[model samples]
Target: MIRTLIFLASLFFINICSAEESKPVTLNVIKTSITVDGKKSEVYDIVQDNGQEGYEGVKGQNFDVLLKNKTNVPVAIHWHGLILPNNQDGVAYITQLPIPPGKSQHYFFPLVQSGTYWMHSHYKLFEQQLMSAPLIINNPNDLYPNYKSITVMLQDFSFTSPDKIFANLKKSSKEKMASMHMDHDMNMSEPDLNDVDYDAFLANRHTLSKPEIIQVSARQKIRLRVINASAATNFWVNTGKLEGALIAVDGNNIKPIKNHKFQVAIAQRLDILLSIPNKKGTYPILAQVEGTKKQTGILLVTPDTKIVLPSKLATSDAPALNDDQERQIHPLNSVVTKPVTKTLHYTLEGNMSDYVWTINKEIWPHVTPLKISKGDQVEMVYTNNSGMSHPMHLHGHVFQVTRIDGKPITNGPLHDTILVMPHSSKTIVFNADNPGIWPMHCHVLYHMEAGMMTTTNYTNYPAPSFYTKMISPQK
Candidate 1:
């Protein structure tokens, strides 16, 4: 009887633990107001019950994303870098339907990978209205008791509504196209930059006039997870005088590159570790816009240190982001490579005069799908024939940069988003182990809205039950 009781008690304890693990963390979607340059602007925000802007959990902690849409409009939030089931990807039309107003949806998936990641709206133009948050997954074993971790989310803000901005872009493109036809001597060597001039640049939703100040101790070690959530701008993260070790990119480990400045393109994340000097001083972590002098950032200061103000614009323009940083990155852990079974070429075609971006010169929703089978190794080559850079993001799988400009690389950094420069070429390889139709598109919000999107379809894979129920079969 004693032995039987002991076994029963153990089973009871296991059941309790499992039940706790299955409980979902609720994230509420609501409209909120933020003051930008003394103007109260209404925006969308995703927050937990405690009113935290984002979610954070340790590795191996399993829970569903119970999204409560409390706003008047529908919403679909994408877990930006997590490799989850295709049905729960939160993409509006691609994987699932949007959660209607006053409705709730549950996203259930196991957290198989851990690193710096984020969540944002995949629906129409909502991301530009600030529907994003940092999703950090910490590995308990990788935790340092003496180190402090800080998250800096970068954004470009405008007072104009997204719909109005998009309409203005279309109007301006037509006029520019007309002017280009009349002037044949226009120089083509200079690449286009800053399509939409933002009213303000922000770090953690605050401009440099009022920056987010972080407290630190003397001689403290710090880990900065900087995420570029900007809609249309690229930035150079300058560490001022302190040198940092760039340890990871896009939530994947990489061979550390020590530098004082690093570039982060749209939808990209950078993890840099630094050591604070043993003196009382303040350090500014600035994010300066590429090809422009506009800047924004936060400050880190030791206790009792005097805070020094920083200017909104730098003295000189920050250079445009190139593949120089991408070329130097190699994965710290070597990924097992499979023999590539499929190879495809795509050209990033677009022009600023007309403002139409496309893959292989074909628009989205009408572009042909790139097909592959389960367990197949795939390689995609992208030649940017446009005058602007494109940060290409693929969902449902992570890939490694295998080549640049026709030169093969060994052990390149694994990323879900890779920036292809103007008039350049980049190649990425991945294993098609996840069976589903996934959207691959430019990370630039306006560029994507202008039709630079496509998909990779799995061969012979049946549509998910939810998807079928949402849409009728074709005749």
Candidate 2:
């Protein structure tokens, strides 16, 4: 009887293993070739969606990400606007080492937020092309009478490689990396690229005329996830044929705002839900950058055979608010928004020519730590002292972008990355729910390597098991 029991138990365990193996799975791996621009190029690196669970409720979609280069370069990838484990945030030399060229760095993080958010390289100009689609996690519980979802990713491209662009900016001598929050002259080169292989702006790898359109049915709720994936450009999203309701920002729920079109700064994400009012054969969702050309990602759905379009997108492109509106919107909200409080502040500062960046004007020492209690509501402000835009971000946390230039978010949306325009400012507020000392810095990777890097601490929280997975372990 004992022998029979053992045999049955072993047989049952094997069957369970077989069943588990049969379940659907996804994977991200390093590959050498991927299709881009209708041609198969020798991609430097590729990441397959190792279809590991990316977030809490996200259904698996294996993203075959295109990494630029002949091979993996020493790169770091941090989901700047995500709540993730410390080891996966992709902070280099501190959390992990750089992923070398001609190679691929595979990363997975729980996609807890369902709205709009993005991913980018944590190193130099790599974000220009190497950065792929913004991973959108949809709410499984959200049966909001909508069957269609659209993703619009915005990006900045140059005729020349980013390597050439940076080198040229450096040669100009007048071009300097300003303090992280300081102001600098915004005089940019005329965007017209000569000898450009890809002279087009893209909304999901396609230009406006040849737009990326998605089809939705009439009278159905269509959720559009807008991601400003650009390295430099800020965008204004135009909703055509669909008058949308602003439902959420940065994957966080907010009171819906009634608006037709809105401005989205670099690195920010907006989630808009719209009802396809009767009559839509084919229409386009366009993203036009101020003072530049436009790109389109299409949503082509049919309840009828009528082509629907708004008279003019700019008809609804309200001018950005002046100082008065800023004040009315972002009222002086309380700092350390805690029923119980723990206070901390680091003054973001920088120098142009020196290319030196600082927190409270001091470069962060690799040995020290940033401190905070778990579950504390943390607020950080970037006061612009120079004349340039800096997209400031925090790892392992997504904060509420509350104010711009001390004004509150009255009607405007919130985002993970708030572009601090030259000499102006923005303040972000959020709860530090996860416990880890995470890095906080500029999303412009080169600026970070220069000096604009720092960390925040959640006291008494040990590092994650993934950190133990580091190949070149530190003592």
Candidate 3:
């Protein structure tokens, strides 16, 4: 009887593993229409066959991203914040080819980490068209059955085509230069913000006038995953009337910091946990546009609470985001120090006159590759000399912000993206355990499109056949 029971248990375990390996989540890439200001505008989305938005899965499981491209144009989806194999980093022409129209591509990998992450297009200007969604991988060990989980994705929308917007920026460079000269002559040093004025800011595809309402129970603990998927805008996430604790940033757990508001830059994600008030009331989690009065967010309402519409704009302008909040963040786990094996320095250089952004004064496709070796500890220091703030993101790795403005930080939080302010410097450190050429660039879409991207290539590493014929993005 004991022998039979052992054989049955082994068979059951094999069956469970087989089931996990066989089931793949299918994300259909299709063009859809969204209502904006009484008009219907076309947008792209990655959804399930049943029209379910985004994806959620368990950590420590085998999963596959079966992307089916139904749109006419080619698409490449980047799994932001996931540290997977280098060949799976989905930059078009760098790691792999774009998925052709009507074709499908499968990405199979192990879910090594769990937290709030996102997926979006790495193709040309597709991200600005709303081709993004939350990619949440829940930690199996976190058995928080009492908490309610919610995701809020913030975006900046424009009625104008992205191509036209790029053209306009190029055409108006001279006017921008003249304005910069005037400001300098007057001795003004305020950093510039909001390069492109968007038609609307959206929270989960809804404006403040018609915000997404999330029903909640009184005294319930809520875990909110907020993603800043905006092309260029930065926002201050305000937890109105309710105190919340920021538990994570960029999908990595950090020491809990209690705050009412936090700044989230483009491509950054924040995970906050808060409890609803015992008395029934409507509370808003608002994202105020940085440097402007515009706001967008969702409402958390209890049963029987009336929904009150919010104004599209705020009463006062929000100040530009700084690094004060970042300095307060520390990793949840004790950081283990490693000896530095390699150090790299880069200067974030650009000018408003030509609207051309570059790393170390060289643009993408022309920039020299930074060399690294596997198993080495790498330290990268970036000095932002330009007048614009940049959120730099590195693919296929999570890094720790070790220094800010030349000051050392003992145990900074780990992040895939870090925001660097104008004339400020930041230093990040990571281990080069994953060997492959990976792109690291500014998260601001226009800046990247204008040539602010470069790659870190491993010394003596072999490149895939497709990588040899790299397609240069138009400058």
Candidate 4:
């Protein structure tokens, strides 16, 4: 019996190693450029060639981002929708060592989540400018409706350099973007409000001299995966001609909402399903941001007809967040407190003048410490006392948005990142199933680096392996 036990243990170890080795892997760091309106531009990229060596490989593959820097400028990448090591969570100076400019960095993980996930430079708000793509983790067990999948990565652009914008934001944090009097105690006059952003917007890296248009035939159900890849801008994604069922958000499935137009905030996503009717000629699909006249990507569906290039859609005056659309419901106490498991509340506090953003008024490298037992149900409240919007994200875990200012969001989907608007409060709950000193902070990469960040530690909560131990709940 002793000999048999030892043999079984050896076999198990060997199997685990081989399985990991068999997971196709490739990594290359290089410079790639895109010609924006006939002008050439270059950006860094960490590419992964999923070594399937066939058309199957083109289906999809997971990749890790390594910050290859020698100047120590702090390079990092966010996995977005991936489960990986705590150190490789990809927030520079937090998860692991930042990739200085002259040094080489690498992120190693698998892409198997399917649906719609993306990767981007997590260094400052530079993500607004570089290394964003449709990271599809093909579902081998796909049991849903079969359709041709099209991935769209939408972006806001600029003729102006990003460096200048960063400088201005650093210089002026209180550059107001329109404020109203929600209070009337006597000081209820029109508050300071100024709507302003630094750049133009694009869909799939192009603007509308000639925008990206999708092709379709009559009677076809197309899967439209849309990603908002901007640094700091919100958009109104609409179909000038085609209407769609809003199906998914941020890689998690949701109850579909039907609307001609809806808000798509920064770092947000939407997957729409549209069944094209058999109509002759072509129809244009348009997606435009509310504030900027610049927009990109319009789908063109034709029924046995030649494609006619669309004339530019007329521009509209920039619009502010309407009260009806920006309705922020508060938590309603429907959330029963999970029995003394674990909880952390960090008042998200920050300033923009010096470009320092923080959680509970403390920046990273020195963040609020949250020590949780493995498998503990964890609840966190992000009270944004600051004036700017922050997209809060927790590494290595997916949580439900349980409450907004104590109001319950009973049917919220599980997510890795939740955007908390300025001056609003949000509460999220998830099992601290993953064990590590994982970084939890604003998904706004720059904001996290500036301040708005925290940590959650799970010490030996008890699972068989490290990966399973961190992610899997132990009942």
- Locate the minimum summed-lDDT window of 10 residues in model 3: 466-475
Backbone steric clashes in candidate 4, count:
45
After superposition, which runs of candidate 1 have C-alpha atoms over 4 Å from their true positions?
A: 1-20, 143-146, 188-191, 351-353, 464-475
User: What is the per-residue lDDT of model 2 for residues 316-414, given as tens digits with 9 covering 90 to 100?
Assistant: 334331233223222122223554354455455555455455555655443244578876777677776644455677777665556677776643434
lDDT comparing candidate 2 with the true structure: 0.56
Model 2: which ten-residue window has the lowest total lDDT?
189-198
Clashing pairs in 1: none
lDDT of 2 at 82: 62
The digit string of per-residue lDDT tens for model 1 on 180-220 reads 68888865455458889799999999999889999988888
Cand. 1 TM to true fold: 0.93
True-structure lDDT of candidate 1:
0.87
Model 3 C-alpha lDDT per residue in residues 1-475, reported as the tens digit of each score? 9999999999999999898669788998889989876767999998997788878887997558789999999999999989899877778978888999999998898989888999999989999999998899999778344578999999999999999988888768767678778787765454469878799999999888778999998999999999999999999999989998998899888878999999898999998999998999999999999999999999999999888877888899999999888889997763336888899998998866788899988888776778899888999999999889999999988899899999998898788999899889999999988888888999999999998889888888887776655534334
lDDT of each prediction vs. the true structure? 0.87, 0.56, 0.88, 0.60
* TM-score winner between candidates 1 and 4: 1
Which runs in model 3 stand beyond 4 Å of their true positions?
A: 1-21, 143-145, 178-191, 334-336, 471-475
